[model samples]
Target: MRLLIFLIIVVPAAEISVLLLSGKTIGFIPTISFIILTGVIGAWLAKRQGLQAIKRVQEQISYGEPPGDALLDGLCVLAGGIFLLAPGFITDFTGFFLLIPAGRNIVKPLLLKIIRKMIDRNQITIYR
Candidate 1:
């Protein structure tokens, strides 16, 4: 799709621009150090959040309830962890936003809507 192509090209270009600007503004060593620090912290946060999501899923299963929401949370955390591990300031920020509960809440409905749309369009298939 055009949007995917735009993102694939634009996002990396933007990320590189920001990274170069950061290095020039803050000095290369400090910029790299900050990036490393954020990656470490983000990984830790993602792990903790992922564990909590797993617990929630288990609890829901024990109650004979569907684990959809918990599963979505796990997905967000997984994506966040991956983004954090990537070398870019924009991705690190997005990774943190996805990993944090408050921010995740802001995104969940949007994600759910997208999933529903995909399912409706037969773009995604779920097997029971």
Candidate 2:
């Protein structure tokens, strides 16, 4: 909870500062163009990854297996896309990592570990 609150406030503030500094150094037009390009690319990747997730889920269902973490993966992708859509280099960089397959693979395990710990601590509950 504390971490979430800190991230919510600090990340955006940091991003804004970085964006302002970069804009001042590189000029506004280039900075805007970079932000827009990232947004467009992120959107395309998000759509493609979303479709892939759906397909994987369908395949699992057909095989009598649950989709399980696929839903979590989809949510991460969505969050990453939203982060990328936000206008800032820090957010865009973080979003890119989340969107990338290799990055997703690395982050997923860490996230699952944290989630498991939270569940074990009774900080979070899983409902069927």
Clashing pairs in 1: none
Over the stretch 2-37, how does candidate 1's per-residue lDDT look in tens digits? 999976898789889999999999999999999999
Question: Per-residue lDDT for 47-79 in model 2, tens only?
Answer: 898888788888888998878678667767887
Whole-structure CA lDDT of model 1 = 0.93
- lDDT scores in order: 0.93, 0.86
After superposing candidate 1 on the true structure, give the runs of residues whose Cα lies further than 4 Å from its correct spot.
Answer: none
- The candidate that wins on lDDT is 1
Clashes of 1: 0
Residue 63 of model 2: what lDDT?
Answer: 94
